[model samples]
Target chain A: MKKLINQPEDAVKEELEGVAAAHGDRLRVHTAPNYIVRADAPVHGKVALVSGGGSGHEPMHGGFVGLGMLDAACPGEVFTSPTPDQVLEAAKAVNGGAGVLLIVKNYSGDVMNFEMAAELAEDEGIEVEQVVIDDDVAVKDSLYTAGRRGVGATVLAEKICGAAAEQRWPLPDVAGLCRKVNANARSMGVALTSCTVPTAGKPTFELADDEIELGIGIHGEPGRERRKLAPAHAIVETLATAVVKDLPFGRGDEVLAFVNGMGGTPLMELYVVYNELHTLLEGWGIAIGRNLIGSYMTSLDMAGCSITLLRLDDELTAFWDAPVNTTGLRWGV
Target chain B: MRDTVTQGGLTAWLRAFAAAVARDREELTDLDAAIGDADHGSNMDRGMQAVVGKLGGLSPDEAGVGVGALLKTVGMTLVSTVGGAAGPLYGSLFLDMGKAAGEDAELTVAQWATAVEAGVRGVQARGKAELGDKTMIDALAPAAEALSAAAACGLSLADALRRTAEAAAQGMKATTPLVARKGRASYLGERSAGHQDPGATSSWLLMQAAAEALASDAPPDRPRT
Candidate 1:
C-alpha cells in the first residue's frame, strides 16, 4: 500500500497528467475518453498505428506514441483494458487518409474492446485493420484457456509496425507485418516479488520470500507454477528455454532478443539476464542479430523480468533499425 | 406483483444493482484475487456508479427516450467506465437487452424473457464463451433459460424473475468447483478451480436486482439495500 500517489483512485489520471507534462513536446494527452496521440498526428498519407491496454504497463502503448512508434495509445485504468470509446476516439484522432491499424494484445478484454472499436470505426467510414499479439508462452493451450496473454513481444511488434507505418506502408501491410511479428515471437516471465496495485491496497499475490512465480503475464495473473527461488542463471535458463523451445528456435535462425525488466527490476540485473541469454542463444546456434535490453514493457512495480525473441529476416531487421523518436525508445533518430 | 416492467422499474433495477455492487466490492475483489488479477469488484462498482451518475444527469429529453434507449445509454456508460473483460461483456448484455426491448415504454413478462435471452446471447457472442466456460455466462445463460421457461409457462412477472434469480444463484454456486476456461482465471488452469467466479457472482447479483426492482412495485428513488 505504500507508494507515491495523491490518491489511489486518481492514480491513472494523475500519472497521465505527469506524462503529458513531461512529454508534451512529442505527444498530446486527450482526456474525457483518455487517449494519447503523437503531437503532430494525422501525418497525412501515413497509416496510423494504435495500441493500448491497462494503465500500469508504462512506456508501453502511451510512451510508444510518437515518431516511428505508435501514433496513439488508449490507456485504461490500472490493470484494466481501455474501453471501445477510448479506442474509437484514438482512431478518429490519428487516422490519416490512408487508414488505421490496431495492435491489440490477446487478452479477452483487450480483444473484445478493440473489436467493438473496430466495428465503430468502420461504421464511421474509416478503414481499420487489427492484429492481435499473443506471444506469451505461459498459457500452454489456446483451446483450454482464453489463449496466451500478450507480453514482451507486444513491444517489439509496436516498434516494427510503427516503423512500417512511418515509411508509408499501407494499413493492411503494416497490420500484416504486425501479425508476422506476433507469429514469430515468443515470451516468458518470472516474478520474484508480487506487485501491489494502488487501488487494491495490497500485493496481487503473496509470493513467499523463498519462492518465485514462473510464466507470469504482465498483469500479475498467476503463472504456470511457483518454485523455490533459484540463481539468476537458472531463472534466465528457465525463461529462455521456455521461449526458445516454444518457437522451437534453432540453428541458423536470426533473432531480435529482448530482455525487459518488470518495473522494479534494475538495468544492471536486466543486463545480467541479457548476458546469460546471449551465451545460451550462442550455445544453441541461434544468432542474436539485434538486441534490446531495458524496461520497455513493464508491470507496475513488479520485481521480475521477461525475455522475448522474434525470429528475424531482412525486412523485419530493416524496420527494426528504422529511425524513431519517442519518450521511451530512441536510437537512429 | 407487477405484470409489466416500466421504464422506472428498469431504472430501479440498475440502481439496486449498483448499490449491491458497492456493498460487496471487497468480496468480488477477493474472489478475483484467487484466480485472476484482483480488480473485478472495484471495476464493477466504478462502472455501476457511473451508470447511476449518468442516469442522474439525464436531460428531460434524454429521459423521455423510453426504456430501450435508456438501457442502451446505460450499456454505453458501462462500456466506457468499466475497464476489463467485464465492461464489454456487461455492456453487450445491456445493449442487446435494449435492442430486444425496442422502443417500448414498458414490457410484459414474455418481452422481458426475450430481452434477457438476447442479452445473454450477446454476452456469449462477444466473449465467445459457451456454457461451462467458467465465465459470467455460467450464471447469465442459465438465468436466461429459466426466465424463458417461466415465460413459456405463462408465469407472472414476479414469479418468472424469481426463478431467473434462483437459476443464476445456483449457477454462481456451481462455478466454485469448475476450472475456468476463459478470462484471466483460465491462466491458472486447474488451480482456478474451487474459487467462485467473480464475474458469475456479479451476474447473479444482477439477476437478483431485477427480481427486487423490476418484479416488484418498488419506488424508483428507493432501491433496496
Candidate 2:
C-alpha cells in the first residue's frame, strides 16, 4: 500500500515519538510501549484519571490528556488498544495513595482492559474504580445486541470525570459521576466516506459517491442503514430523533449538546449540522444547558458527524462546568 | 484430540499470534482503509506489541486478574492508542475473551473455544453489523463456527484451530459480492457491493496465525492456490 511513512511497523512508534516531542512538556512518555500520561499525574494525593485506546482518533484520548481530563493516556498503535503493561505502569505511576479512576467507553475492548487495570491496582492495595460509557443511541439492542455505543459522550465523560478527580473527590464519588454522565448521555453519528488505514493503505469500507451511512459509530461499526445522500437538516433530524427516543427527554429537563465531526467532515458541515440540530431541539421544547461543537472524538478522516446530548442535573452540571485543561476539551475552571 | 489447552500451549499460541499481527499490521490496515478505518493493521500490531511487552514477567499470582484483565488492558490501550473503528472492535474481542478467560490459571481446549465464542458474540453485539455485512464477523463467525463443529468432531486442539482458520479464510473471501452493511463502506449503499471487506481480510489473518501456531495437528483443508 502506498502512503507517507518510512515503514509500516514503525508508523505508530515514529508517530508517538513525534507526539511526545511536540507535547512533552505537558505529557510524560510511557516506556513499556507508546503511552502518554499527564505531566502532573498523581498530583500528590489526588485521584488519578486514566483513559485511552487507539491512535487514529487523535486529539481524542491523547488530546484530552491534561489537568481536568485524563491523568494518563496509553496510546496504542493506530486503531489498536494499548497493552496491559502500559496501562499498569500508568496506574502505578499515577497512583498517589488516593486511588485512581478509569474512564472507558462502552466498546468491549476498552471496558475489559480498564476492568483489568482496576483488578491489578487492587492487587497492590491501590483502590481503583471504573465506569464504562455506552451512550450511542443509533444501534438498537437486538437478539445479539451488546447495548449502546460510546460516541461523542466519551469526551464529555472525560471532561466531567477529570473535573471530579481534580476536585480530589474520593474514587467512588468520581466513579459514580462518570457513570452518571454515561447514563445520561446519548450520541448518534453518520458517515459519507471511508477512511483508509495507514497500514492497510486502503479504506476500511467502500462508500459510493452518492450514499451515506447513518447512525454510524466513531469506529466505523455498521450504522442503522444506508441511504442516498440527503440534506443536512434531514440527517440532523434522523440522528436527533434516535437520541431523543432513547433518552426520552423530560418536559423541562436541561441538556448539554455536542455536535462532533468525524475527521473528514469540516467545520462548515458540522456547523450546518449544528444549526439543524438546534432548530430541532427547539421544536422538541428541550432546553440546551450547554453545548460542544467540534471533533472532540473522531474516526480518522471519515466524512461524518455524531450528535450527543447529556441530560443534566445540578451535580452533573457543576461537574460539566468544572475546569478541564486537556488538549481537546479545555474550558471553565 | 486433547480435551485441554495447557497454559504453555496457550501462551505459545498467544505469543505467536501477537507476533503475526505485528508482522502483518500494515497489510491489515491497508485492507481496512479500503472500506473502513485505515488503521486495523497498525492497531492490532500495536495491541499485540503491548501484550508482548506485558508478558515479560507474567506470574501465576496474576491469575485472580482474569483474562478480562489482560484483554481489558489491551482494550483500553487500543481505545487510546489506535484510532478509528478497529481499536474498539478488536478491543471488544479481547475484552470478551478476557471476561471468559477470567482468572483461570490455564485454559482447557473447550474453555478456550468458549472464550473465543464469547468474544465473537461480543463483537457481533457491539458492532451490530452481521456476518453478511462484510466486516470482521465474516471471518470471525466462520472461524468460531468451524471450531465449534471441530470440537464436536473430537479433533485435536491443533486440528480444530486449523479448521477454524480454513473456514475463516473462506468467510473472508465470501465478502467480495456482498454489499457493505457496516462501518464506513455501508455508506456506499449499492456501490460497496463488489469490493472485499478489509476487516474480514484481517480477521482471517488472526485465524490463520492461531491455526498455524496453536493447532498444527489439525488436518484442515489448506487455502487453494
Candidate 3:
C-alpha cells in the first residue's frame, strides 16, 4: 500500500515509460500492445530471442533486452502473464529472417499464451520455436501440480541462449541450448515477507514476523511449507540442499552458482545467503565456475532469495562466459 | 419447450455469466488465495465485464449475428483483457466453441453439445491438462461430456443444459480433494489439496449461467445458493 507510484492502474505503463526513456539507447518500447524490443533488433541473419512474464520482476524479460540477452520482452500487468498478441507482435518485430525463439516460463498462463503466439506466428509464415523453463525445484513434480515453476534459471537461460543467438546460432540450435539449460538447472526460493500487489492494495499473503515461507514462487503465492524463521545459513542450506539434490549434482560437476534476491531483500542479505551457498557447495565438492549474485528476478517488494545452480559442461560454460550487456546483467563485454 | 438455442439465448448466457462472475468474484479470489495467486475472481470479472459490454453492442435481432461470431468476439475480448491462465483457458474454450458452432444462428441440442465438447477439447489442448488435473477442465470436461451424453439421448436442449450444469457443479466440488497438476496451484504440492479449485468454480458458474439462460425461465440475476 505504501509504495512510490502515481496510480495503481498506471504502474505498468509508467514503469515501462521510465524503462524506455532510461534505456533508449539499447531498447525500443512499443505501446498499444506493450513490448520492448532491442534497439538494434532485426540483427541480420541471427535468430531472435523473446521472453516475457508478469511485470513486477523488473529487468527480467525487459531490462535483459540488449546486446547479449533477450531481443524482445512482452511484460504483462503486475503478476499477470502477457497476452498472445503481445508475443506475436514482439516476434514479428524481432524476427531477423533466421526465425524466432520464445523463451517461455512454465506457468500455465505463460505457456498457453506463448504457444498460441507461436501458432499465430507460424500462420503468418514466421518460423517460431519455443522452450519452456521449469527449473524451480520447490514445486514438486507430481500428478497434482504443473511441475516446477520457472524462477532464477530463466534469467540464466536467457543469458546463455542470447549469447548463442548472438553467435548466429540457428533457431533450432538456440532453442535446443535453451532446453539444455533448463534441464541442467534447478532453483529454490524462501520468502521472509509477503509482497503487496498494487491493485490488490494489500499483501498477497500474510507472513508472521517469526515465520518464513519456503519454496515460494515469484508471485507471492504461499510456498510449499511455512516454518519458523531461521538464520541465513540454515535458510541457504535448505534452499541449496533442495536444488542440489533435485539436480543430484555430483561432486565433480561444474556449476554456475546464481544467488538471486527477491526484490525486497538487500544485496547484503543475498551475499550472506551466497556465502552460505558457496561454503555448502564447496563442502559438496561442486566447483563454482561462473557466478551471478544479485536481484536478477524478483517478486514485488518481497524479502526473499532463490538459489539456482546450472550444471555446466564445456559448451554451456563457454556460453555463460560469453560477453553480455543489459540493464539487469552486464560483464564480459 | 425450446428444442434449440438461438443467438439471443447465447447472448443471455454470456450476460448471466458476467453477472454470476461479478457476484462470485470475491469467493473465487478467496479460493485462489489458498492454493494459487488470489486474482481469479478479479481477472474473470474484468474479462466478463468486457464481454458483456461488447455483447451489448450487438443487435438484438438473431439474424444480425451468428452465435459463432458473437462467441468468437467474446473469446477474443477475454483473451485480450484477462491477464492470467484463466483468460487464455476460458478464451480458448469460447473461441473453440465458436469455431465448432460456425455460422449457426440457432443450434440444436446436439449441435450445442458438439460446441461444448470442442470448447473443452480446446482448453485441454491449450492448457495440456488431463481429466484429473485440478483445473477448470475438472468441471468443464465433465460438463461437456454430460452435455454430449444427454444430447445423444435425445433430451431437449433445456434438459441437456441443466444436466451439464449439474455435472459441472459436481466436478467443481470434486476438486476439493484433488491435488493440482497444472497452473500456479500446483506449486503447493500436497498442501494444495482441500481447497476447491477456483478455475473449476468459475467454470461451474459459467455452466450454471448457460442453464439459467437456456434451460429455465428464471431471471438472469436470480440468486443461486
Candidate 4:
C-alpha cells in the first residue's frame, strides 16, 4: 500500500506516460489501455507482430517492441493479461496490409485472451495468426492442467519470428517457425525470494531465508519444489540437469544458452548461474552457440532466475543469429 | 418463498458483481500481491467489463443461454482480460457453468444449482485441483455443494444461497490452513502456507455476491446457527 506514486490507480498510466515520452518517436499508445505500437508500423506490407502479458515482466512485451522484433506490445497490469480490445487494436494498427501474427506466452490466460483477440480481429475482416510459446520445462506438460508456462525463449521466438516476418514470410510459415522454436526449447526457473509488486507492496509469496524454489514460472509463482538454498553452481547444475533431461541436448548438441533473472536477482548472480551452466553443458559435451542473460522477462521483483536451453538445427542456428533490434536486445542489425 | 430471481435480477447480479469488483479491485490485487501475482483484481475487473459489455442489449432470460455459449463467452473474456492462473480457473468455472446452463432460456433456482454443479465439474476438469488445494475450487466447490444440498431440501432461492454463502465463507476460511497445491502460491512450498489464497478468497466473494443479489424476497432469518 505504501509506495512512491501519484496514486495506486495511476501507476500503470503514469508508467505509460513516461514510456510515451521516452519512446514516442517509434511508439504510440493504442486506444486500449497500456497498449504500445510502432508509430509507423506494419508499413502496410509487413507482418504485424503483437505480444503482451502481465505488466510486471516489463522490458519484455513492451521493451521488445520495435523493428526486427514486435510491431506492437500490449502491457497489461502487473501479472495480468492485456484486454482483448487492446490486443485487437494492436493487431489492427500493425496489420499493414499483411496478416497479423500474435506472439503469445503459453500461460492459460495469455493464450485464451490472444485467441479471443484473434477472433475479434477476424470478425473485423483482418486475418490473424498466432504463435504460442510453451518452452518452459519446469512443470510437467502432463501435470499442466492449465498449459506450459512460456519463459525466456520468448525472446528468441519473437526475434526469429520477427526475422521471418521481415523476410515477408507468410503468416503460416512464420507461425511454423515459432512453433519449431517452442518445440525445441526447454526452460526451468527457481526463486530465492518472492518479488514485491508495487501495488501490493509485498512479496507475492514468502520464501524462507534458507529455502529456494525450483522450476518457477515467469510470474514469480512457486516452482515445482522448494529446497534448501544451494550454491550458485549447484543451482545451475540443477537447472541444466532438468533442461537437458527433458529436452536431452545430445553430446554434440548446439544450443542457445539463456540465463534469465526472474526480476530482482542481479546480473552478478545470473553470471554465477551462467558460469555453472556453461561448465555443466560442457561436461555433457553440448555446445552453447549463443548466450543471452538479463532480466529480459521477469516477475515483479522476485529474487531468482531461470535457465533455458534450445537445441538448434541448421535452420534454427541461422535464425538465432539473425538481426534483431529492440529495447531489450539488439544484434546483427 | 417464491422464486424471486428474475431476468432483471440476473442483469442486476452481473452489474452489481462488476461494480463490487471495480470497487475492491485494489484489495483483491493486494491479496494477490501477498500470495500470488498482483493482477487478480485488474484481471477480474477487465473481464467483468467485457462481461458487462457483452450483456448490453441482452435480456435477463437470454442471459441463461447455454452454458457453452455463456461460458465460452465468459471464458474468452477472462482469458483475454485476466492474466495468471486465476483467469483460467475462473474462466473454466464459467465455461463449466455455461456448459451446464446448456441452451436454457431461464433456469429456476434448482436449475441454477444444477448449472453451478456442471460449472464445478468443468473447473475440476480444467484445473485437476480438488478442494483444499488452495485454489478457487476450495470455496467454489463447497458453495456449489451447499447450494445443491439446500435445493434438494426444497428451499427457495433465498435459503439455498444463504447456505451457499455460508459454505463459501467457511471454504474461504479453510484455505488459510492448507498448503497451496496450485498456481503461484504452490511454488512457495511450505512458505506458501500461512497466507490465505487470494483467488479462493475472491471466489468466496463471488459466491457471496451471487447469493446476495439473486435471492428471492424472503424474511430475514434469526441469528447464525
The DockQ assigned to candidate 2 is 0.11
| Every model's TM-score | 0.97, 0.69, 0.94, 0.77
**Which window of 10 residues has the lowest lDDT sum in candidate 1 chain A?**
A216-225
In angstroms, how far off is B172's CA in candidate 3? Answer: 1.8
Candidate 2 Cα outliers beyond 4 Å, as residue runs: A1-8, B1-225
The clash number for model 1 is: 0
Instruction: Show where candidate 3 strays beyond 4 Å.
Output: B58-65, B215-225
Instruction: Indicate the residue-level lDDT of A214 in model 4.
Output: 88
lDDT of 2 by residue, A142-211 (tens): 2334456677888888888888878888889888888888888888889998776675566766789999
Error of 4 at B111 (Å): 6.8
Clashes of each: 0, 71, 5, 12
Tens-digit lDDT track of model 1 for B176-206: 9999999988888898888999999999999
- Ordered by DockQ, highest first, the candidates read 1, 3, 4, 2
TM-score for candidate 2, residues paired by index = 0.69
Candidate 1 — which pairs collide?
none
The alpha-carbon deviation from the true structure for residue A219 of candidate 1, after best TM-score superposition, in angstroms, is 1.3
The TM-score of predicted model 1 comes to 0.97
Give DockQ: model 4. 0.24
Candidate 3: interface RMSD equals 1.5
